[model samples]
Target: MAAGRLSFRNITALAPMVRVGTLPMRLLALDYGADLVYCEELIDLKMVQCQRVVNEVLETVDFIAPDDRVMFRTCMREKDRVVFQMGTADPDRALAVARLVEKDVAAIDVNMGCPKEYSTKGGMGVALLSDPDKIEAILKKLVTGVSIPVTCKIRILPSVEETVSLVQRIEKTGIAAIAVHGRFKEERPRHPVHCDYIQAVAGAVSIPVIANGGSLDLVRTHADVEEFRKATSASSVMLARAAMWNASVFRSQGLLPVETVMEEYLRYAVQYDNHAFNTKYCLCQMLRDKVESPLGKQVQAAQTNAEISEAYGLQEFYQQTQDRLQTKRDTLQRSSQPSCPVMDGDIITMAIKFERREYPPQITPKMFLLEWSRREKLEQPRYKTVQRSQDRAFQSTVTVAKKKYRSSLWEKSKKFAEQASAIVCLRVLGIPEGRLGEDDSGLVCKRKREGRSNGNSEEERGKKLHVEAEASEPAAPAEGEGPNHPTQLAGTL
Candidate 1:
């Protein structure tokens, strides 16, 4: 190759061979003497809205060393409101996002390759590929606005002619370089990769091309790269899971994997997870392909069979017995792979650093309040509305704490209610005015409904005298004094 770089299946490297990291795992951290480390490809617009989510991402990547050559990758996908409602797209949405993430990384990449429907709806991700003009506009805008190198990922179109056309069209846009995901997105699942598409696109465009997809392990990576080299006569390759899960693969000088590695893997998994089940799930995937390897040839390729059976002849369940936190089956069934992975040492360390621990997360009072409210008699507390159910209990707890702060007010209101009706009626009836005349005292009423007013007036006058006598009368005191002196009690008591 003129560039002096080695060739892999349709992927060409320009001399400086670099090791790259996969999505979520950055390339700069790996010690491949990489050209640069690019972050994952799914930093969506929603991330911009939620300061907490944005802060978490920043903290994870904030410590990027200068020599590490860190960079950010955001898929230039459609702005699906459903996907990004938590964070949405404003006219200055891209610029707003750029301001938040402090970058020491080499470049900021906008993704246009992701084909997820939610992404497309947002007018950002892979949908841009359908219109080169729009992508060029986006690229030009980003290039002008940002200070870093801007790059993009492309996919082969259904027709080779279209792929060539798209490449030639995008090539003129003046991006720093380009990479191609060889499969037509429609052929995502198990379709054969047409490596020639990469070659065609490379020839069509003058920029550097990075090849992606297909090779998952070193055994196959060697073969895949070998074919890739033969097919395109190009250099360099990109890997995801293999490079990330086993850092040794890049450093192994091509050694085949072993069961001992799996044992170490389990050790790390337990260490990182602290007995959580996620470690188990990852362990199962890592050991999935070993069945055909030398250590695995003795065993059958039974992915579903988690219990290493006598038929496969490999069972070292006792490895887990040493740790009280772990337990393993003496024998695995005739399954294809174990449900969970058990990892060891460096891999575990790498995971512990990159992957978050599955533990009881730190919570604030507000989270507890939300959880408590969810359990309230109200139709449904706000907990159901929150996407994160795990924090519901915490959020509701805070809700109740605030309620506690105001509970005294509620109790005081309840106590006053018993006398409220009588108080209100007395006020309404014009509280005693000065004299207790026949009418004002309620001993007589001028009722039109009565038989006769004059007759009632004369009867009232006579009744009034009796009413006064009764009002002036006093009963004997409780201890048998003839009567209490009203003059003394009213004046002094």
Candidate 2:
């Protein structure tokens, strides 16, 4: 490897998988002795729109989307060992994404091996294999444009000679390393990997060659990793399905039981505050054929991390992690307070952000506030929003029952800022914010009437209100529902 680049020499690594290569799985592979880990392949188009955020509560650096979804997350623990992989066909777009994340990752890997339609339809992934000139341009652009090591993962061509010629062309682009998945573009997992083709490419290229695609056939155990490396004559070995099924396959001693590995993975999932759906998906992949077992059925039915923890008998661990996260958030909130307590106009402001994970899925603070207003027969809330020119962060103030509320913290989008303001109002009014632990609070604001001529049940009404709140701005106050009406305020605790 060149100076300032990650070395791919004689090491075992976790391959970049579609959904299986998330933070929890990457951290687990590191814990079990993998030399380097790769995050899942992200499209360059999606990455360019993300805003990087330092999440103090989760203790990770998050690339958050405009809708507040986490596109990619990594903590300081894996700073030097995590490789970011992205799919792109354009040289400029690929360079833009590489520049965006070069400082945070150890290296950048262009994904050229994926055969999925989603990647190929966009002229990315395996589609790059058919365009050698475009591949050279993209790789060279990244290598010369970014400060980090640039690499590419590619599938073998139809023949060994063709594969060697392609890798030799890739080497001239000044990449630090190349990972060759020893299969043709049309080959599936059931087809045998062509180790001879990988070896030919390794021999042709002076740069380090990382061999991949030998999971179920040649590489089943920890010891098989070296066997696969020797067979392909490559600098290192990368595991996907083998590591997905059992991350401890990287352990030199022996592979641990699937159950033990699953339990340990859940611990990391909870500690990192991973999304419940992702955690469950990784667990199911580990289960494999055992997915038909009773425990598997229970895990399959789980909708939340807490439910998954109960299935794995790790509820206590889950609760402790949640409690620790809450405490960290509270401490950070206090630390963000201004010492002089300057007032914004006449209303006092406090720091707050709308953390989507704290509430149930598809539920927001704005939805709760809207339901409350309708229940009390008060006018709908109105919001005044503004976006900062320099950073594009938005701040909003929402009026409920003639009282205006706003958060000191600016959010990434107007919707999030409005939700933050609603949170402040909900807190001041002594109402539950409908967080996960609040009992029946989400249901309290629903209509009490059992029957309606319009045929909208309580659930239906709540869903309709949620849609209206999210899709449109707050409605204007009625003629008599102005601030001068002097309505009774909800009592504070």
Candidate 3:
């Protein structure tokens, strides 16, 4: 039971959030005091197939430096602090991808916590929970194949005994650490986090156990962090959605307004030249609390990164928000302290109250976009048929009952729709689904081959480092039989 298993000195880290967690977000988290960060879950085979291509294609982009050759998802500022996570069912693919980015990252984390159907349907993510033997084999191969540390992230089971046993077995694989999301596969974000189970697992495992879920309270984050640390006694805590809302939550002081947070994030997005969809998604999350306000309505209706910038008023908004925040802070400080040097009569206890104001209700983005589209169709009768066709296609995709496939279609459609229109209409207009043209296959092939050259040298080094334990037969745990399947298909964290 060595204390050295945990690599980072500080306990706070950012969780791997799909799409929302980008390189800019990672760097921002590190800048604000997060000890470590993780890139979102990348599909193992897809990464192996396309890593070279993604790198090669993006190399010409000015923002991506030469040092980011191996791991384009990480930046120079936090290369040593970022870990790469992947979802995979195959041991070879897992090892291949782990070795692919070992030099660029702090460690490699296998995602066993994802409850989305796309992951489970492919026998990856939480599906491995049903077969612990497979989990051990995959992890063993990764540990033996790479020079850097290997770890895993997992969801809890129904019984504490089963959960504790699952972690103990993983510990024997010589993993550096394990992060336990304190919820069952069936539990959603709103469900109560099972801290008791996290505590049980932490007590059972000798390696560092990081506790996650339900501890990130956006309004009372500092208190929540302390509570989670005290309750689980785990090595550290992982902040997922809360950090997305406010990366400054990693900083100990100051309660930043939603507008300020959005402005800061926009600056990062500009510096990174993040994809439109990802940049827009982060804005949506940041404005979750302000969606009812006038500015919020315009922000939500934005389709492109440029529209988002315009809606936010960019630098003007940043300066105004900063002034407002400073004024509030100065007033609060004045109200809290005494004015006189000496006491006269008995001091009167004054209950200083701050005024709470809610933004006025405004037309939502959905309503505005829907109305705006109708007006355009009426004004331009000639373009009506084309608009109708696009709407029908989007409707068909949404009506389908397949949750996994629907989510996939929705994202693709949303990406295309946003590009065509000036506003992101996923939450607004049910737009048309974009079809893949004849050139898609060729595009895919080129992307797959992008990073192939660099992987060749690493593959040789990986083979030489493989341990004999990777060849042993690992038995599956007899405790859990059926797949610990997800309760629903709609979830991302």
In terms of TM-score, which candidate is strongest?
Answer: 2
lDDT (Cα, tens digit) per residue for candidate 2, span 1-493: 3324677788788999998898999999999999999999999989989998888888889887765668899999898899999999999999988888877889999999999999999999999999999999999899889888888999998888888888898999999889999988898999999999888888887888999999969999998998999999999999999999999999999999999999999998888877788999999999999998999999999988899999999989999987787677657765886533235886646577888789765466776777788778877777776665323456777888887888887766677778888888888777777776676664443332221327766577556655655555534342223222322222110
lDDT of 1: 0.37
- lDDT score of model 2? 0.83
**TM-score of every model?**
0.44, 0.75, 0.60
**How does model 3 fare in lDDT?**
0.60
- Put the candidates in TM-score order, highest first: 2, 3, 1
Clashing pairs in 2: none
Which parts of model 2 have CA positions greater than 4 angstroms off?
Answer: 1-4, 339-348, 351-403, 406-493
Best lDDT goes to which candidate? 2
User: Residue-wise lDDT of candidate 1 within 399-487, one digit each (tens)?
Assistant: 12122111100001111211121122222233321121213332223232132445656456445533543343232222222111111
Q: What's the CA RMSD for each of the models?
A: 26.9, 10.6, 27.1
1 or 3: which has the higher lDDT?
3
Off by over 4 Å in 1: 1-38, 52-92, 102-104, 216-219, 222-230, 233-235, 241-247, 256-282, 289-493
In order of listing, the candidates' clash counts read: 72, 0, 6
Model 3 Cα lDDT, one tens digit per residue, 197-304: 999998887788888895444224645676776687787888887788788878887457767777778866654446556777887787776777887777667765
